[model samples]
Target: MKGMDVCFSGLLTRAKHLADAGENRSDLAFSLQESAFSMLVEVAERAMAHCDKKELLLGGGVACSKILQEKCRIMCEERGAQMFVPANEFLVDNAAMIAWQGVLEKRKANKNYDEWQPNPQWRTDEVKVDWR
Candidate 1:
């Protein structure tokens, strides 16, 4: 489908091949992590540049990775940007961020908010955020 999906599929195929070849699992995992995180950092750098943003805020479970954090910090430093990462406790999937996002959504919602139904499969780009 999308270019990213294809790239990810290729990565998975490569990882599977490595495993099937009886490669050391730890080494394979490390290689995969490095490749994935490098790609992520590249994409983040592009996005920051495209948006003319000087601040990088990382969240979610992946943000908890020390390697990823370091990569982000390096990118930020190179770009003279500020990187903000929550404490480890808040880096992973936690209810506090969800609650805070809900609070923000509720505040932005109009009178039609009650009619909005939660779609478990909702995609970030699919929703039309009129609340903004």
Candidate 2:
């Protein structure tokens, strides 16, 4: 929930309030790490409400967490949506992957080859290396 706008902790506090008001419900989800369970659940639920539940894909570094994966599975099942998570290699980061992505985007941008100096701290918006 680091970048998430919704506060799960606040939701938990509201759930506690509901419990105090005699509406004892235990449907809760949480993660101590930067996992995508909450976002996946939210997206799945929203999609299920509109379309057929068969087109949700979750793939990233956060997708491998046990709590996240299992919770996403349960949320998808409950919402009648399908959740797809690829293997761990697809989730983890590697420099080869970075180079591959750079090559692909470079090709699409019609970038011409030139002497490119690598920066240790390159921000996408800051650097405008027009190879073409």
Candidate 3:
């Protein structure tokens, strides 16, 4: 996990704990959320530049955070870039999404099927995927 991811996770856990404790700290909750958003925006900016991609696509479970979504929007606006997010149903963990991505990967490989486990350590940038 990246530094931003760790920070965001910690903030989110703290926020959830506070919310569950029946402590109505809207201001604090919002602040924590904003911090998480800031971390994501920073990570996204660095990632986009590293990949030389004018537009960055954020996917998976974390993309559903409304705060993060807004942050990403603002960050992209500042840079005159764009961010793409998949539908909510597709963002979370689902067999269809996994199978779909696997099919695309298999197509790229252009080889026969072979049983394999989905790598828990899969790194997006390290994978050979031809999204274009």
* TM-scores of all candidate predictions against the true structure: 0.65, 0.41, 0.53
lDDT by residue (tens digit), candidate 1, 23-130? 898998898898888888888888899899999999888899889999999999999999999897877776786787777777787436677687644555676765
The ten-residue window of minimal lDDT in model 3 covers 1-10
Write candidate 3's Cα lDDT for 46-100 as tens digits. 8777877779787878788877888889888988898898889878756677789
Q: If the candidates were sorted by their TM-score against the true structure, best first, what order would they fall in?
A: 1, 3, 2
**TM-score, predicted candidate 1 vs. hidden true structure:** 0.65
Regarding TM-score, does 1 or 3 come out ahead? 1
lDDT of 2: 0.62
- The candidate scoring highest on TM-score is 1
**Best candidate, lDDT-wise?**
1
**Candidate lDDT values, in order:** 0.80, 0.62, 0.75
> Cα lDDT of model 3 overall?
0.75
Error of 3 at 28 (Å): 2.0
Worst lDDT 10-window in candidate 1: 1-10
